[model samples]
Target: MAILPEPVTLSLICILVMMCVKILMDQTKKNKYHFPPGPRPLPLIGNMHILDIKRQDYTFMELAKTYGTFFTFHFGRAKAVVLIGYEANQEALVKANYDFGDRAPMPIADDFQKNHGVIFSNGETWKITRRFTLSILRDLGMGKRPIEERIINELQYLNALIGSHNGKPFNEKVFYNATPNITFSILFGRRFDYDNPNYKKMIGIIDDVVKLTGQPEAKYYNVFPIIKYFFKTPGLVVKRVNELNEVLHEMFKEAQEAKTEDSFRTYSEAFLQKQEREKATETTEKIFTEKNLLASTFDLMVGGTETTSSTLKWAILLMMKYPDVQKKVHDEIENVIGLERPPKWEDHKVLPYCLAVMHEVQRFGNILQYLPHSTPTDVSFRGYTIPKGTIVVPLFSSVLYDETKWEDPRGFNPNHFLDANGKFLKRDEFFAFSKGRRVCAGETLARMELFMFFTGMLQKFSFTPPPGVKKEDLDLTADPFFIMRPKRYYVIATPTI
Candidate 1:
C-alpha cells in the first residue's frame, strides 16, 4: 500500500478524533436524560435522510405514529423535538408557553433579522415589541370599527379591480395587490393605489422573499448554512430583503419627518414617538431603535399580507370547486346582508353559514403549517426532557387536521363548523392563528380582512373555474412557499350583483 503524506495522515487522524468526541458527547447526553424516542440519526445528515424537506410536517406526522406526539429529530447535527397533534402542541404552546416561547434560531432569519423583530425575536425584545405592537394596532382600530371601515373602503378598490376582470379567467393573485394595502393603511396611515409603481414593486419584493424563503433550498440552507456558500438562492433572498429594507427605511424616514407632537396617525408614527420617549428617559437600555422599527414593520407587513391573501385565494378556489357550498354562502349573504349593502363585521354574527364557510376555508387552507419555537431552558415535556435551546416544531397542520377533532378532517366540509340546526360552531381545535405567547399578532386584522373580503366578494361575484375547466378538475395542490398558497389558478368572477 502506498504511504499517505504526513499532513494528510494528520488531517485524517484529527477528523476521526473529532467524530469520536461527538459520538461520546451524544452518548453521554443520551445516558443523562430521557430524551424523546425517534429514529436513530446517522452521522452528518441526522434524520434528514428520512425527511422530505419540502413537506417535513407530513413526514413528522407519519413519524408520530411510531414515536408518539413528541419525538427527537435532527437537522444535520442540530437536535430538535417535533411536537405533533393538538394535545402536544397545546401543552407546549398554551399550557407551558413560558418554557417553549423563545423563537428558534433559524440561520436565515438570524442573517436577515438579527433578532430585531417580533416574529424571530425573543426575551425582552419580543416582549416590548409585541406589547407596543398590539397596543398601537388596537389604538389604530384593529378588530374594531375604524379598521373595519378601512377594510370596507379597501374592498371597493379590490371589487373594482376584480370587476375590471369582467368575469374573464384571471389569476387569483390579484388579491395580493389589495390585501397588503389594508396592512399599509394601519402601518403608514395610508393605502396605495392598486396601479402605483412603488406599491407594485414593494409587493413584488415581498412576494419574492416569501417564495424564496419557503423553497426547499431555503430549508436546506437553514440546516446546512455552508450550502449558502455554494448556492445563489440564499444570496438572492438577502438581496431582496435589503431592497425591501430600503423601501421600509424610506417610509420610516418619511414617518419621522412627518411626525407631530403627542399625536400618532399610524403604527410607524407610534413607534417613533415611543422611541423618542425611550431616548429621553435616563435608562441605559435602548429598546426602541431604528433597527427594531424596521424589523417590526417588516414583520407586520409580511405577516399581514401573505397569510391573509393566501387564505383569500384558498377561499375563492374552494368556492369555485364546491359551487353548492358557494351557493349556500351566497344565499345566506343575500338573506342576511343582501347585495345592496356590503357585508360588515356585524353581519358575520347573523350570517352563520357564511361564517361557517369562512372558518372552514381557514381550517382547510392551513396556510402556515408550522412556526418553529425553542425551549428557553431545559424543558420536561410530556415525559421527555428537551434540552435548553433545542428547536421545537409545533406542527399546526397536525392540529388543524387532527382525526379525533373533526368529523371529516380531510374533506372540505363547512359542516365541520356548523351544527345540525346550521348554527356556527366554534371549535378550539381550529389552530389557524396559532396559540399562546407567539400567536399571530395580526389575528384581529386578519380576521376582519377575511370576513370583509370573502363575504364582499361573494356578494358581488359568482366565482367559477375557467371556461371549459370542470370544478372537479380544479387543483387545490398548494404551491410550496414560506406561506402555503394555492398554486397559480384562474377563475371567472361573474358579477352576481
Candidate 2:
C-alpha cells in the first residue's frame, strides 16, 4: 500500500468536512420550516423509485390517500409540493393564486419555449401575453355569433369529409385534420383544404411534438437534464419546434404585408399591430416581440388544436360504447333541430341532454391530467412553509375522480352533469380546463367547438363499433401519451337521415 502526501491527505479531509457541514445546514433548514410530509426518498433519485412516471397523476392520488392532500414529492433533487382534492387545489389555485400561479419549469419545454409563450412563461410575460391573447380572441368573436358562424361553416367541410367515409369504418385520427381547421380559421382568417400539403405537414409536426412531450424519455429529461447529451427525444423536440417556427414565420410575413390600420382581421394581424405599437412607444417595455409572436402562436395553435380534437374523438368513442346514451342524444337532437336542419350553437340551450353528455365527455375523458405550477415566493400554504420556486402540481385527476364529489367516480355516467329534472347541472368540481388565474385561455372557444361539432355529428350520423367488435370490447384505456388520448379504434358513422 502506498501512503498519500500530507498536503493531499489534509485537502481530502477538509473537503469531507465541508460536505458534512453543508448537509447539516440543509437538514437544519428543513427541520426549521414546517414542510409537508412525504415518503422517504433515497439520495440522488428522490422518490422516483416509488413513482410511476407514466401515470404520475394516479401515483400522486394514491400517495395523497396516505399523506393527505398537501404533501412534498421529490423528483431527483427537485422538490414539488403536490396539492390534491378540490378544496386544496381550489385554495392554492384560486385563493392563493398569486403565490402559486407561476408555471413550473420543465427541461424540454424550457429549452424550446425559453419562457417566451403564454402557456409556460412566468411573471410579466405570462400576464401580458395571456391578457393580449384573451382580448384578441374576444375581439375576433371567441364567444360571439361570428365565431359560431365560422364553426357552423367549418362543420360543412367536416361533414363532407366524414360523409365520404359512407358508413365505412374509419380511424378516429381523421378528426385531427378536421378539428384544427377551426383554430386555423381563427388564427389566420382562413381555413386550409383538408388535403393541402402545408396543412398536413403542420399537423404532423404538432402531433410528433405532443407525442414526444408525453414520452417517458422526455419526463426523464425533466428530472435529469444531463441525459439530453445521451438521449435523442429532447433534441428531436427542439428540431420539431424549429420546424413549426418556420411555418409560423411564413404566416407572420403574410400578416405583416396584409396589415391595415382600419380593422383587425385575424389574430396574427392584431399581434403584428400590437408589435408595431410597442416598437413605436419608447418608454414602455416591449412585451410583444417577434419571438413572442412565434411562442404565442405556437401555444395557441397547439393548445387550441390537440385538446379539442382529442375530446371530440373521445365523445364519438363514448357514444359508440353506450348506444343508449347515443339514442338519447339523437332523440334530443331530433326533437330540437330535426334531421333536415343543421345544428347551431343556439340549439344547445334547448338540448339539455346533449349539453350534459358534452360536459360528461370532458370530465370522463380527462385528456390533461395536470399541468405543473410553481410558487413565485416563499409562502405558507395550509400550515406548510413552501419555499420560493417550489414546483406545485394541483392534481386534476384527484378532483375529477374524488369519491366524495361524484357518486360514480370511476364509472362513465352522464348523470354527473345532469339534475334530477333532466337539465344541465354545472359542477364546480370539474377541472377539465383547470382553475383560477391559469385556467385554460381557450375554454370558451373549446366549449363552442365541442357543443357545435359534437351535436352536428350526432345529427348527421350515428357512431357505432366496426362490424364484429362489440361495445364491451372497445377499450377505454387512454394511450400512453402526455395527453390522455383514446387509443386507435375504428368507428362506423351511419347517416341517420
Candidate 3:
C-alpha cells in the first residue's frame, strides 16, 4: 500500500524515464561521434589508472607507441586527444590553426592566473588582452632596442652576482633572481634588489607553487573539474597565488602613483590607460580592467621568469654534467667575444657554437613538456573527428625528441643544431615555444634574454660541479614539476678571467 502511494509511484516513474534518456543519449553519442583511436576507457576513473601519473610526458610517449600518432584518451570522464610527432601536431595545431586554437580548461592554471590573462582566456577577452599586451611590450622595447639595452645592463648585475661567489659553489637561488629581474624590471619599470625581503618571498612562493602544479596529485584537479570542486588539494596553490597577487598588487599601486597621464612608464601604466579609455567609451565590460592587467602582467612575469630561467638552469646543469661540451662552448665564446667583456643579444651572429648550445638547451630542456590546446568546435583533424572542447596535448616531448627529427633523440647534443662545418642550424621540429596563435607571445624577449644571460654567465665563468663530485656522477636529471628544472645542486662558477 505504501509503495503504491502517489509520491512513491511518481518517483519510480521519474527515475525510469531519466534512465531511458541517459541510455538513449549514450547510444546517440556512440553512433554520431567518430573519436580517434585509443584504448577503451573504463567507467568513472577512465584512463587515469593506465597513465604514469608522475611524468606525464613519459606517459604520453609510451601511449603514442601503442595508439599511434593521434589517439583519444580520458582523464576521468573527460575526453582528451593527444597529438604526437611533428606532422600530427603541425597539421592540427598549425595548418588547421583556429580550429584547435582555444586554450584547454585547466583548473590549476585558472587558479594560478585567476582566468583573466591571455594564457587561459578565450574569445574577445583573450584577443583584447593579447593585442594590448603586445603593443605595450613593444613600446617598452620588449623585443627591440631599449629592451636589449635593459637586458645587457641587467647582465652586469647578474655577472656581478655570480662573481660574488668567488668561484665557490652556489645553488639555483642566485640564477633564479638574476633571470627574473630582467623581466621584472620591464614589467614594473624597476629592478628588485635580489636581497629585498619582498623579492625573496615572491620568488620562493612562485617556485614552490609551480612545483605543486605538475605533480600527479595536483594535476588531477586540473583535468577533472569534480576533483577541484570536491577536494581541498588546491589550498596551498591558492595561498601562494594570493601571496603573489599581493606582491603584484603592491607593484601596480607603486606604478599607478608614479605614472603621469601622458607618460606610461611600465606595463601597468599602459594597461591602466587602456582601462580609462575603455571606461570613457562606455564599454565598461571590457577586459581592460586592473584584474586583466595584473593577470596579463603575472602571465608575462611567471612565463618570462620560468622558461628562460629554467632553460638556463638546465644549461648550467648540462654543461656541468658534460664538461667536454662546456669546454667547447667556452672555447667558442672565447674565440668570438673573449673574456674581457660580456655577451650581447647580437653576439649570436658570431657565436655559432654558443647559439647551438642554447637551442639544444631549449630542445632538451623541454621546459613546458606537455603543451595543451583545445578544439573550439568539431574539428576533423587528419581523418579523425574531435568533438568540441576535447583537450589536445601537442606533446612537446615527442617533437623535441622525435627519432626522425633528431639524429640522437636521447642525448644532450648541441650538435643537433649544428652542421658538419659547425654552423648553427635552426630546426623546425624545435617546438619549445610551441606553435600557432597560442605560440609564446614573449618569445622574442625570451630568446634575447636567454642568449644574453646564458652567454653573459659563460663569458665570465666556466660552470663545473663541486670538488669531489665527478662530472660522470653529477645528476643532470630534472626535478619533475610543472617545469623541468635542474635538481638542486651546487656548481662552481670559476671565472674565465
What does the lDDT come to for candidate 2? 0.89
Q: Compute the lDDT of residue 360 as modeled in candidate 2.
A: 88
Q: For all the candidates, what are their Cα RMSDs to the real structure?
A: 5.7, 4.5, 3.7
Report lDDT (Cα) of residue 199, candidate 2. Answer: 89
Residue range 208-248, candidate 3, lDDT tens digits: 87788767668888767667666665777878877888888
For 293-374, candidate 2 gives per-residue lDDT tens digits of: 8888888888899999999999999998999999999999998789887777787789989998998898889898888999
Could you tell me the lDDT of residue 29 within candidate 3? 77
TM-score, per-candidate, Cα-based: 0.94, 0.94, 0.93
Q: Could you tell me which 10 consecutive residues in candidate 3 have the lowest summed lDDT?
A: 224-233
Per the 3 Å backbone cut-off, how many clashing residue pairs does candidate 3 have? Answer: 0
Looking at model 1, residue 218 earns an lDDT score of: 88
Runs off by more than 4 Å, candidate 1: 1-30
- The sequence of per-residue lDDT tens digits that candidate 1 reaches over residues 373-476 is 99898888777777888888999999999998888888899999989998989988989999999999999889889989999989999999887999989998
